[model samples]
Target: MSPSLSIATTVSPASLAGTLVSNSKNVLCSLHWKNNDATKTNRNLKFRVCSVSGGYNTSVENVPFPRDYVELISQAKEAVELAMKDEKQLMEIEFPTSGLASVPGDGEGATEMTGSINMIREFCDRLLAPEKARTTRIFFPEANEVKFAQNTVFGGTYFKLDYLTKPSLFEDFGFFERVKMADRVKPEDELFLVAYPYFNVNEMLVVEELYKEAVVNTERKLIIFNGELDRIRSGYYPKFFYPKLAALTKTLLPKMETVYYIHNFKGQKGGVLFRCYPGPWQVLRRTRNKYICVHQQESMPSLKEVALDILASA
Candidate 1:
């Protein structure tokens, strides 16, 4: 018999509040701007207000503006606009379902979600814009061809690109080696994109190194194309891996500016995006045991909801 599946969208008010409080205390501090008639003149203030109220954790105090306050506000506005535009594109894309018809944990279905390639392309295009060019970095461990194709299509300077022939997480690299690797990440690199991180999640030390880089370098954003949640829940992964991944996510949540968990579920028509904040630890714990069967539509969350949540947080 197939394992039972159910849509997971039961976030209580308490959970939302917890997330907001956590975000306000940790991530959204630098984005906060003093309210004034000058702010009223800024077109992006509305976006800032929505971000703060919805869950960004920005403060609305009467602090004085900095010397280059205008420039700062302009940069923030651009970031907000870029994030909004990207979120919209993510929602409208017709997420191809050709490869998602099989049941989870089935031999090929677990590793062959080729349909997500389109989504990754879209993400790469958006993140490679000239405005985001310098600060956006993408690491693709498995898809060198895709990266090369994107470089050909989008130009070589679109974003900083790196590929690992072997999964860094699985390699026998020690902590210092990992740290040395992490040191290559420039402080200006704000966005970190990891495409189709499959078995890499099992490499806890490598994952730790990545998160440690984010912590040491603040304002870093993590966007992961993770399709392994269902596989983990189905017991394809070792029992210890789930807890370790969850713990790492929790530990990093309080440090990184944003951690977007973009998942494409099998048998679902669209992708589901999650903002891992406040209580990603709790969320991951709940998701670890849930088996999403082919027939369980109600058990899965919709892509639209996930997109909206991302916009609100942005």
Candidate 2:
């Protein structure tokens, strides 16, 4: 059964507006900015991002993260667990589905958007406490992706798999019926995990709306799991073409704490860009079974710069 036909129901624009207006009023009432420094450092994230000396231990065995797929999921889970321990409401966890051989860019990695389904399920199962497991709602890019995930990766409706967009007859022409955030979230829900929302550029704008309408002033927390935001960060989606998504680099993304991340570069100067919550971003080179950190910075470095400049010199 196709996800569009089987799962998605028609939603009238008037009904969507009614629900959105109701939620928008509530969100607006509580909307206010937190102190900049407080938003960045108030959480006191568990991972201590400290200065790394030149002789810092960089062995892969000594490194806490995993290299293989199964273990990588665990590492991602741990990173989120640490982020959960912090006070940050918006967080992100991103990595390559293709074993870190390449960056998680569109049309490059090994079906990362699709492959992220199982990883989200496994890690969420491990990361969420038993009591909080059922309270987390997982949102996918489309209803079809939700149906596909339920059958394949989820193995029969383990968690609530919802979707950001509903396909329309004009979907191939870049049109979709967007579900309102107010209609999707329930009062019982405590967490919202959006899985690979990068499939459509508008999906991310919906995410920003979801944050503003549902999560901003509530006890709820949200995680952008593998949204491949680097596409926006790297300007792959030109601002002139995708102004909303491009603006996210400043608006929604700055508010997010990247709890876990890994992007790889393949070349003679190939290296990995890695960071865990509270840890400084590190540029690492694989050595046999281990990794050696050649550079570390408090802020994330550009993948191009790392691949071309930093690693080239290191």
Steric clash count of candidate 2: 0
What tens-digit string does per-residue lDDT give for candidate 2 at 59-81? Answer: 11112334456656665666677
Q: Tell me the tens digit of each residue's lDDT in model 1 across 79-115.
A: 4344544441111111112322223344354233343
* Candidate 1 regions with alpha-carbon error over 4 angstroms: 1-117, 142-157, 164-180, 201-205, 215-217, 230-236, 240-314
**Candidate that scores best on TM-score:** 2
TM-score, predicted candidate 2 vs. hidden true structure: 0.77
Clashing pairs in 2: none
Give one clash count per candidate, in the order shown: 5, 0
lDDT of all predictions: 0.37, 0.69
